[model samples]
Target: MTTRSSPLPARLKSLLLLSCFLGGIGLMHAENWPRFRGPSGQGLSTEKRLPLHWSATSNVVWKVAIPGEGWSSPIVWGKRVFVTTVTDQSTRCRVLCLDRDSGELIWDRTVFEIVPLRKESKNSYATPTPVTDGKRVYAVFGDGSMAALDFKGGVVWTNREISFYSRHGLGASPVLHDGLLIMPFDGSNRVLKAGIWPNTSDEERLGWQIPWDKAFIVAVDARTGRRIWTASRGKSRIAHVTPNIHGTGRKAELISPAGDVIQGFDLRTGERLWTAYSQGEGVTPSFAMGEGLVFTASGFEKTTIRTLRLGGRGDVTSTHVAWEQRRGVPSQPSLLYLAPHLHSVTDGGVAHCYQAASGEVIYAERVGGNYSASPVAGAGHIYFLSENGETVVIRQGAEFSVVARNAIQEKTQASMAVSNGRLFIRTAGNLYCIGSKH
Candidate 1:
């Protein structure tokens, strides 16, 4: 006798399809590091089995010498790794793609070229990291030139609407959200007869020490590179902060910070939603949001860690600030808020942990290195990379307990990227992939 089987119920079939769709999403998240600090623009990785111990030779799956100079971090999408560099005497801004597993150059394309502007000694002509949406890679050069390229190294489009000029150059990387590419050009005045280095006089320090009104934030369509909208920051000093998105859906806001101010804008229209006054110039650290609170460091002058409550319209400086702590403020590295505790490391290498809710200090200990790269967390540990190529790993908690210290003994300024259980560290001249070969 032949037996017949009944088909699944309609509701059961719907549920099965949803499960497969969500599983595909989770797999995508585990395999890609598509932007500056990973998929979120905040240095947090979900990949497990990341290498905890690596050196110049040990635990290194592959190492390739990159051409030219760029402090921009490497970004990964699937089997490809992307990074930007400026070669030919800082006149040619180029993008390079490499094989993620084999460390071989897949393609190299020059996005644009320009007469490089005078930047800070530590800054580079290609300091802004590129962002990828799995199909195309978007990069912004120091001169405010932006371009989008396909996976095969063909240029799709380029935009040069803004001629960017910053005493510190372009350090803020562009961020991609909901088919829009957002970038901030918080720069100084175009003409300053006092030259590159400002003097003590306020006249000579027009844009460096004092704020200017030329600063603006822009958003462009990711696919066509067409200008969508531009929001003006009336008067603000130069900054190198990459913006991050907060909340979701219609209520979503872009949290962007420049010197002397931090503001939120509607993600779709670039409408200024709120503003908070922060002091000092040349701000570099980006915002860290969690538990409906935003954490950022005040740049230069008197540095401090300021925490603000989310949601408030117009100037919320007086109404939304929850607390301000002047200790352990980082001038370069971005703040890392890991659940109940907020973690920060100063440029001088002193690490501090604080209660995220009350802003109370839990512990402050010296880690011993000058840091330029921001801290990243994964596999139950926080990795802080220093300018001198030392990584101090500490367990995630209120206590100041260090897990391990790994060193490659090379000069490193770019933040590390984690993907598929490997750490991509960009030193001065080479990119090292750290993971077990097995």
Candidate 2:
């Protein structure tokens, strides 16, 4: 009798990995953290059972030490999780992929070499979160270098056609839609000349911000990195808001918040469709889309929440603006748009709930500790990640009630990612996966 040996262990493992990469292992159409915030480009996810409480020791799935510094949140697709970090002491922009099941380092690929720019004490060189559409991942750095990589860390393309340097470094993450990679280039030469960005005592004269004339939104082919179109923001100041893809069918629009003005771009051709005067500078909060309205927090100065009607042309500041509220608007954290109520947490730790359409303040409560991460909602609860790595879970409703306080006791600035009932938190030194069973 002839006996046949089973396939080798290594070959079986490889085949299994390939199958998972091709959407095996019960991985359906749902994406975990494919983009900056999560699927739908909002902080909210459809995850039903994220961990309610977890300390550094409790409910700890795995903790992996990350090299260098990065404020970008971890993104996931199928069985893999990808995060961008600066290696070689912030001199190289690199992408690290980890196996979602075991937290094993699958691969590490350095995309580009970048000189350190004068960033704020809180900002990092690898601040922009990498986004993926399952088959490939896209990572961009503050130096305006971008690259595309396959599932196995093979580099597919690199595009350096757009060069950018911000005095506060780059915080605007790229968004993908309609086969285009959209990036916001907002920096201030005035701030660079004044040496105003936090007084970093770099001996290399670390501040270099070009004039506002060069600041605009650029669209490149997501698969090929080919330039598609460029739209000038026109005298807009520095902003860090990410674009929100809203509307449906032929009326789809890319609503982006530019400092001093907010505008909508055509998703297909990068055409300037509509414009509004946001009347602010350093706008950081990403625009929230819901109920045919676009809501935004006009950054540090002239801070307020502006809600505008979806479709408008030219200057729609007065014509299409539904309401403007100045109550507990956050400068850094974006709001959670859950139909009737818009939830938000300020950098100073005050949480507020507002009526979505009319801009009416429902309730304002102080949850404590500074927050830079935006609010993400799942399983009928909203989560707010503070700068000190304290995740305050609150029941979402008309009245704000604290559900639980989970403290990890680490420094975290990146927003949290939720998917498949798991919460991914990225701190200054490590990446922790909660709700994972070892």
Could you say which candidate leads in lDDT? Answer: 1
Checking candidate 2 for backbone clashes, the offending pairs are none
Model 1, 1-438: lDDT tens digits are: 998789999999999999999988865564689999898888989886678887898999999999999999999999999999999999999999999989999999998888878788999988999999999999999889999999999999999877787767888999999999999998876553444545557744655678888899999999999999999987888889999999888888899988888999998888899999988888998778899999989759878788999999999999999999998999999999899989999999999999999889999999999999999999899999999898999988977788889999999899999988899999999999999874
Instruction: Give the number of the best model, judged by TM-score.
Output: 1
TM-score of each: 0.92, 0.88
Superposed Cα RMSD, model 1: 4.4
lDDT by residue (36-109, candidate 2, tens digit) is: 88988888788656789899989988899988889998999988989999988799889999988678999999
The true-versus-predicted C-alpha distance at residue 151 of model 1, in Å, is 0.6
For all candidates in order, the CA lDDT equals 0.90, 0.83
lDDT of 2: 0.83
* Candidate 2, superposed: residue stretches over 4 Å from native: 1-31, 190-211, 436-438
